[model samples]
Target: MKFGRRQFIGTTVGAAAALSAPAVLGQARPRVVVIGGGAGGATAARYVAKDSKGAIDVTLIEPTRRYYTCFFSNLYIGGFHEMAALGHGYGKLASDYGVNVLHDYAIGVDRGAKTVALAGGGSVPYDRLILSPGIDFKEGSVPGWDLTSQNAMPHAYKGGTQAELLKAQVEAMPEGGVFCMVAPPNPYRCPPGPYERVSMVAHVLKARNPTAKILIVDPKPKFSKQALFEEGWQDHYAGMVDRIGPDFGGDVVEVRPDSMEVVIDGTVEKVDVCNVIPAMKAGHIAALAGVTDEAGWAPVVPASMQSRMDENIHVLGDAAQQGDMPKSGFAANSQAKVCAMAVRAALTGSKVFPAKFSNTCWSLIETDDGVKVGATYKPTEEKIAKVDGFISQTGEAAGLRKRTYEESIGWYAGITADMFG
Candidate 1:
């Protein structure tokens, strides 16, 4: 479905909801500076510029020249998608929406001055700031693993090159090789992402090296769509996959990147490839802005997506600690629209409608085999609460699964277009 403004769910948080106060315009046109042009930032920039009809100035700052969608990155590892296909550019947002797209890093956020400092030694002042920067790894969350050890044991958590490196590493493993993955704890980006990656890796090994083993050492006792993934794994790659949940010392684990060893409860096992997904926090920019809480996520108002710390700034995507919403691309994109509307209302004295949000996360277990979990959310007094939800049932027909997979393909096209355009 097209995700502009939807009917806000309940009468609980009604149309009476509004921002604390509209920004006092520093310029004739209210300027909105968006940091990290992924799903959240890009969509927010586009929506604010488009909806305002040139009334608001939107500038998007993202260091990458090309952006990759982490949602479908696992398919690339499974040989179902090409790297080029996963990449997108901001040319359309610039040319079509008149957004000033800057390919520079945001080094600091001066909340007092309402300006963002760029790595290029320039700063851009904003009437309202939108931060959609994604997740960052918690330092030393995975024992003996850090960014320096990333090459030896790749954590393909972020969107781009790490996925490439991980796929390459998986392909290079010898016959009957062991591919080990240390899955992240809860509240990470994409709850099902690591499991989907595991499924994709299993898909590759099943095709190339039939005897190869796939091992997952996960800290969590159970994961998103656990029943569905387990059912799919059993149906397709029966004996090829093995997961060690928290009960089996999956929580107490360490990795020695130099030796390619995974120490599970002090039992070291040398593996051919290790995909280490460490615990994560909000993107560093959120912390720099002093918007993030002790848990390392920027909490926001459900109605406006404005930061709890600073109302002039809004947090979107994986960075925001809005309740009941998983830190996924779809969730971020959904949150951004609400934010965009609120920002516009605050800036231009436009109508602020009640906010409705929704998200659906699709995962591919095998070719033509897909499953999803999703829900619609409404703003309540305390948090963005789940209104209703649905999931793909176990033992679903082949045709349905195929249709679900195809639906994801269409969603990819629709969402990317929605974000960039």
Candidate 2:
């Protein structure tokens, strides 16, 4: 009845507070769903769940129960590392971090509804989504090659079973038989991967059949760590490995898996083994989400890894078109951490830190002959630009090379733990 200035203010404030109770008390837990749980997706999911301390609901969608890393898989082929060492699992992420691990493929994405359709039938809704689907091939990049023929001339780029197949094929080659590799072009998953694989193939052949030859048909005029790899090749596997560059018809090639023949500029040659790594693009799920650009890579804001096409979804690892960073497991792991921080901040009003990234890729040339290239990166307004870099020198001391190899062994252990644990 007596509503003075103070009474009027108190009555209005009470009414406003009453109206806002449900909004405050009935808020849903923020959900983050991650697809392709390899280096990027797994790391992102784990970090968001672990650091959030049950505040955020994290779900990891991966078709496979066991995840085999592409990194260091070459060592398995070369007999330096074991296949078991390359394999990882999701038990820790699920049990320790409380992550909901779904062993199902992400078939489609409804960005408008913020839900992801799974091969297992139901759709998973999320407040935010992380996609790190890695690399997929552009069909017909190599003539007469397609998914159906992959078993004949295995790419072995995806690790696990493919790596095993390539290894078995290499070991079974006849004495003095030829092994041919058709390398991928620039901006592929790993710049040094094809060359490193060549080194591994030579390692196997040199020990088993000393007269066997390994041929590399490369499109790029030069490759990652060219000087160092050349020196190592000549010193250890001399007269065993021959790399054909673009000038000598390396870039133009066709393969006949039926006959095990490689035609370089119309010069057909028979081979006992063929490893064809076709040109790569973002995985199919990224395109299904409608986040990828014309180049088939999802474009992102370097600072946050948020897709330019859809802010609610973030792209990491090989799928994102972030500049200057190679599509290595190390690079993807780094990007995942940066993305995790940004996503948590957006959801929980946490303090966001400045984005920084780094990557080091180690390639084994021979036993105890290891080389590496890496750089630190910072996000700019335009892209993620390199800050500083390092590389092993040519003719480095034997002790130093051994030490570099040891460092790689330690790194593989550390990164795996960081991803799964």
Candidate 3:
């Protein structure tokens, strides 16, 4: 409703009746410890507190006070948005929503004890736990590339400083310099993300360095919005972008950060700037909780995003494997609602609505030129099956595209408010 900004639960006769029975246990309110403060965790924390009306104790653990959203960092890279616009503080969530926002990393999750161990040497006990730890790269996914080499070849995939570093690298490149991207494999966060990053790079290069070249070495044969992105590249930044897929040995690639070289199918190319998006897995906290499977993603029940390993633990965002629903900010935010509803019902005996989820991923190709793919979903016996979907048509009008871009901007504002307030 109105793009997730609608107040989930407010004062009403039904809600008042629901709160008649307090959910407190052992002289304390029901504790909901959220191990992240991004789209999923932030929204969950806000909703659990807001809807429960102090019946639930919501504590959010996030290492950063100001979160830089990966969703719009590409626009920042393209100069369409400022870094300041991408930063969101937890003040509103703390002051307005009555959420205990802790700026700390959650190092461990003790399932048996139902406590989260913080790096600061204290443990937070929770009756219910929500884990939205986004994504972490797979070790050795990109040979010779690790945290140490991140400064040289920034992934920029996580948003924040990495994105700023990549922007600076692109801006500092010489005229006609080469920019290479080693795209991640399938099922990573944001399927269309790498292409969107390429578009952002092209947008910068087109204005600042017209002769600059952008190269993409992608492991996937086809990417999200392939034809639309390819068409936009041809029409907006022709001859400036080139994509090498697995059919062309794109999968067989390695990066030598020391030499600033990318080996594509054994052919070495010295690039002026490199962006390596490695294969991703669930965030470290999920694995620490012992909820992740061999594939490094936590499985959840379709109706509720509760972890299969522990019913008390719910996993959202990129860390969850709920099936079909792409790992995206919108998806996470949507899933958080379902999980919040379920958690409240289980704890406070509130009415539990059937889970229905939706997601829309918007990508900007150039200034005021945007495209989107979205779907409505419902839970099935096997997975979260897609009900239907829509995408930007190939021959859409420019006016429509501009409207879509504006809609996305509005969505950014609405969703952030929904999460924080």
**Candidates 1 and 3, the one with greater TM-score:** 3
Query: Total clashes, candidate 3?
Result: 0
Clashing pairs in 3: none
What TM-score should be assigned to candidate 1? Answer: 0.94
Q: How do the predictions measure up, each by TM-score?
A: 0.94, 0.94, 0.95
Evaluated against the true structure, the overall lDDT of model 1 is 0.89
TM-score of 3: 0.95
* Predicted candidate 2 versus true structure: per-residue lDDT over 72-150, tens digit per residue: 9999999999999899999999999999999999999999999999988999999999999999999889998888888
Model 3 misplacement above 4 A = 1-21, 24-27
Sliding window of 10 residues with minimal summed lDDT for model 1: 3-12
In candidate 3, what are the lDDT values of residues 4-86, reduced to their tens digit? Answer: 22332221112112332465567677899999888999988988888888888899999998998999999999999999989
Error in Å for residue 49 of model 3: 0.3
lDDT of 1 by residue, 98-127 (tens): 999999999999999999999999899999
Alpha-carbon RMSD, candidate 2:
11.5
Q: What is the lDDT of residue 418 in candidate 3?
A: 71
Determine the backbone clash count of candidate 2: 0
Residue ranges of candidate 1 with Cα displaced over 4 Å = 1-27
